[model samples]
Target: MQRKEALDILHSKLKKKNLVKHSLACEIGMKRIAEYLGEDADLWGLAGLLHDIDYEEIEDAEEHGKKGASFLKGKLDDKVVKAIERHTGYIEPKSTMDIALYALDPLTGLIIAAMLMHPSKTLAEIDTKFVLKKFKQKGFARGANREQILACEKISIPLDDFVNIVLKAMQEINEELTG
Candidate 1:
């Protein structure tokens, strides 16, 4: 499906404004990471954008990724659907796409938290170094798992490069994300 079609589906399911923006951030980050890794950007992006489609509808907290996967099973590529399921660590990320989503999930949160804390409060104003400092702070963006963010290194993508690519992707869509 096209991005617009996916956005329509995403919007239909998600109620929170911030959650939608988070999905957008994930889409951009997923696409950029796919490009960086010479992977299929479209499928990876759809996975990222829809990974949290079950967020607001989750009955059981543990059903997060499972619900999303079930919802998306036949709608998208199986690989993308599986990546969405594996992203939450419900199943360990095995594919490059799965690992990227696993790592990219919290990484976007980290970047968003870093942007919010920036003096200028803009993604453009914060680099990976600034975000790295925040990563070391135990109390900062407590929901953004530092260990998962570090999973970039597991896939042979250096942590710094992952941060840089994701940060730049968010910056490119700063207005959409910040507004």
Candidate 2:
């Protein structure tokens, strides 16, 4: 399916505005990472955009990616479905997209939390240095998994460069993200 159709499904299921924004951020993150790694940006971005599609609908957290994967089996590429399933830690990450999603997902949350804490309260105000500092504070953005984000190393992307790429990609979507 195309992005418009994927977005339609996302909007229909996710009532919370923040979740939609999060998905959008993930889309940007996936695309940016793919570009950096010379992967298929469209396919990876689709996986990121739909990774949490079942979050609001699934009662059990364990079923999050599985449900979304099942729903998307016929619609999306098998690789995309697998990436979505792997994203929630429902399964071990096996592909490049899977590993990237597992890491990038929580980093997006961390970035947003950092933006909210910034004096300017804008994506533009947050830089890699500032984010790295916030990242070191365990109490800040506790939901963001430092360990998972560090998984970028498995794909040969250092934490600093990974964060920089994702952050820049997010900056491009500032309005939709902060809205």
Candidate 3:
């Protein structure tokens, strides 16, 4: 399916504004990573955008990816479905796209959390150094899995570079995400 259709599905399922913003932030991160890796940006963006489609609906946290994939089975490509399913890290990420989603998903949350902690509370005021420092702190954004974010290393992208790329991507869409 196209981006617009995928977004419509996301909006229909996720009622909370924060959830939508998170998905959009992930989409920006995915698109940036896909570009850097010479992959399909649109497809990667869609996978990131819809990865949490069932988060609010699924009672069990583990079922979020599986059920979301099931919900979008016919509408999205099988690879996209599998990426969405594997994004939660319950399933091993086997493909580049899968790994990208897995790595990008939580990092978006971490980036946002890091930005919020900044005195300015804006993307422009935040930088890679700040985010990397926060990444190392055990008590910071505890919910954003550090291991999952480190998945970028499997693709040979250094943690610092990955964090910078994601941070810049989110910054480009700062208004839509934070406003």
- What is the lDDT, from 0 to 100, of the residue 174 in candidate 3? 89
Scored against the true structure, residue 147 in model 2 reaches a CA lDDT of: 92
lDDT of each: 0.92, 0.93, 0.92
Please give, for residues 28-138, the per-residue lDDT of candidate 2 as tens digits.
Answer: 999999999999999899998999988988888888899889999999999999999989776898889999999999999999999889999999889999999999999
Model 3: per-residue lDDT, tens digit, 1-179?
A: 89889889999999999999999999989999999999889998999899999999898877879999998898888999999999988889999899989998889999889989999999888999999999999999999999999999998889999999999999999899999
Once all C-alphas are superposed, what RMSD does model 3 give against the true structure?
0.8
lDDT of 1 by residue, 28-144 (tens): 999999999999898889998999999998888778899889988788899999998899886898999999999999999989888889999888789989988998999999999
Indicate the residue-level lDDT of 96 in model 3: 88
- The segments of candidate 1 whose C-alpha lies over 4 angstroms from its true place after superposition are none
What lDDT, from 0 to 1, does candidate 3 have?
A: 0.92
Model 3 segments more than 4 A misplaced: none
TM-scores of the models, in the order given? 0.97, 0.98, 0.98
Whose lDDT is greatest here? Answer: 2
